[model samples]
Target: MSKVYSTQELIEILAQERRSCMNGQRLNLAASVSGNPVIDRFLKPEGIQKFSAYNDFKAAVHSYQRQHQVSGIIWCELTMKGKTLRYPAIDEQLAALDSDLKILKAAKADLLEFWYTGIQGMDLYLSINFGKDYQKIMPNDVKEVAQKTEWANLYEYKNYNFWEIILQLGWGKPEEASYKRGWPKSGSEYIHAVNPGKCPIC
Candidate 1:
């Protein structure tokens, strides 16, 4: 069975995972599942849709931290059980991710791609394929946010290797999608080829 997470719980999990990666741990997308719903959800293509350049994302987080009295920025949405839950509204407090791919590109990162997610929604996943010699430094806001998860308790998903993780999880139906695939359960399969909402992995 899959574990569920409250919004706050999920954010902490994501922060932990990001910190682990930042500390020089490698995550093999094809074989890793943190076994936590929110972290797993953020691992998907949908989460990656929201973005700006890393620096821009950090700036937004800093601005939000000051004006809103929050610690930093991350993708945020409502979720019930292991599925992403969203209300029909635009969260202006959140960073605008619509132009993130372009912004990340302007920063000179390579390997830019985006996937469509209903209406005008899209996510950014900058590969930063420069390898370790050119690894981008983890933004201070991100470090600050993750460090203060208990206080900030906010995070958002943005596209980055999310699409690839989706591909690794396989597609079509639960039976095939879950077999020998990275996804741990069949119930998490995306049930629709179109009109997939925030949770593509169900």
Candidate 2:
């Protein structure tokens, strides 16, 4: 029988994986805000005019991941037509982006729960679906789990310090879950409250 872990177990597993991959090196909090030049190319004003579709965004992320030899988490914040959007779940967004970019190899979706057990912290659970392709290089089961199990949900704790993507899995449903359970009251509040300081971004 296949091994199935609980949500908390999955979170601990992913967190350990993240720590191992980092080699104990602390991640730069500003890396996401600084943005990748390749990513910035598509996100800039002119680039936005040229590549406005979500597929384009996905392509840029895939390309960036390939070149950097890094994988795990990705975060995006954007404004279009005076409407602003912040993507807290980096893995899910990337999965959707991969589909849009036609790069999705294997796709899967499951409910995931996230919680923060710290003062001035946050605790909420939500569902997240994950997908991946692996460029046709890795083993089947490895790719399957990599695409499906590797991802983290986003939580904005404080201003200008949004927590980047972190890895989590096997999230079960909460008693009082809703479609809009964990979202903040406003964009400003989201930016202020969701910081990496409060959450792990691996």
lDDT tens digits, residues 93-128, model 2?
Answer: 222232222221211122112122221233222223
Local accuracy of candidate 1 as per-residue lDDT tens digits, 26-111: 33334444579888876843223222222233354535434444322233343322445322211223222324323322321111
Candidate 2, which ten residues in sequence have the lowest lDDT sum?
A: 185-194
Write down the RMSD of all candidates, one decimal each: 21.2, 19.4
- The true-versus-predicted C-alpha distance at residue 158 of model 2, in Å, is 5.7
Going through the candidates in order, what is the number of backbone clashes in each?
14, 13
After superposition, candidate 1 runs with Cα above 4 Å error: 1-6, 25-186, 193-202
Error at 190, model 2, angstroms: 14
Off by over 4 Å in 2: 1-58, 72-116, 119-150, 157-202
- Could you estimate the TM-score for every candidate? 0.17, 0.21
The deviation in Å at residue 139 for candidate 2 is 36
